[model samples]
Target: MTAFGISAFGAYVPRLRLDRAIIADAHRWAMPGLRSAAKGSRAFANWDEDAITMAVEAARDALADRDLSKVAALRLASTSLPFADLQNAAIVARAIDAPHQIASSDVAGSQRAGTSALLQALKGTQAELVIGSDHPSAKPASVQELTF
Candidate 1:
């Protein structure tokens, strides 16, 4: 049996961190409990950020000191994918200038997507790159907005 493992890894967080207090103040009347989470900040994706873009950024980070040619596959995991019918992993692979022969796939639909993709990648025959990102949009003054 062959052992599959991560040879290199990297991560990227959005520069913008929205203070939870802002959300609590904005909807304190509707959802008073939001104040409880006002101690920390949440990553805020830019207007142009989608799962593909963020995944590309993260992949670039991971590949910065490594050879892109060694990557055999690219897997993207996200719940807030921009396109419902498009190939997200392919886009990310292209944006990062990955080799044309590299296999690409997307894992989505739930929070488990990230972990599931990682597990799948670890079982693959070659070096696999798995990326996860989310850009959730929610209604104003709703608890969903505060949480997501």
Candidate 2:
């Protein structure tokens, strides 16, 4: 039987970080509960960075010192995709200069979007590049803002 498995992997976290304390302090006056969760910081993307850009960087990191021509498929997962109607994965593939013949797609909608894509890739019979990236949108002073 043929074998399919992950040979390499890479991840990218933005340089900017938003301290949970900052988030808590902003809302603690109204929601003192936030103070309990304000221990660590979360990655904050820059104005120029988005799901697509981060995915590209991670893919590049994984593909570093390797041949891009061998990549057979690309899958990008996120809850904060820049475009709702565009094929985001194609953009990522193009950004990485991945070959034109490879398959590419975007996955989103559910919180498990990334996990689902990863599971599918692992079960499939082709060499796939799966990336899970998110920049969730949360309302100010809301629980999501402090936790997400």
Candidate 3:
């Protein structure tokens, strides 16, 4: 049988960008060699923008050319889920007006959770929509946080 393919894809980078100078100044003491290039810019989530909103934007783009009713399942992968216990995938499904019976769930914790969710969706029987996003934090002067 033929395997599934991506119908569409979308990415949303927040409008606000924190200058490298500010970051470098704040972390100059902590990170000796923290330069602008070393510490790339950061995207700031707007007041109303959360994981759910970002996921909705991505899902909307992914469903652009497809029928919402055809989406039977939605898998959301995120390490920065706004709510600890709530199902963010359901919120994304509702936002996109997907079928009422569509299966929805969240995969979180590790960065690898994205791959896990994708693998699970691909192995499943239903037509699936998988969305992954991350907003990981690091120490103020940590290189990992600055690079991303």
In candidate 3, stretches whose alpha carbon ends up further than 4 angstroms from where it belongs are 1-3, 36-40
Instruction: Give lDDT tens digits, candidate 2, residues 1-148.
Output: 7666778989899998898999999887899888888888887789999899999999899888988777788999999899988999999989988899989989999889999899989988778899888877788877788676
lDDT of 1 by residue, 24-132 (tens): 8988888888787677777878888877777888889888878889888888999989988888899888888899999998899889999999999987788889998
TM-score (C-alpha) between model 1 and the true structure: 0.88
Residue 11, candidate 2: C-alpha displacement in angstroms: 0.6
Instruction: Give the TM-scores of the predictions, in the order they appear.
Output: 0.88, 0.89, 0.86
Clashing pairs in 3: none
- Pitting candidate 2 against candidate 3, the one with the higher TM-score is 2
* Model 3 lDDT per residue over 9-123, tens place: 7887778888776777877887767775554567877788888888888777767778877677899999898888778888888888888999998999887888999999878
How many clashing residue pairs are found in candidate 3? Answer: 0
Please give the lDDT score at residue 58 for candidate 1: 86
Report, for every candidate in turn, its global Cα lDDT versus the true structure: 0.85, 0.87, 0.80
User: How far is each candidate from the true structure, as Cα RMSD in Å?
Assistant: 2.0, 1.7, 2.1
For candidate 1, what is the total of clashing residue pairs? 0
Between candidates 1 and 2, the one scoring higher on TM-score is 2
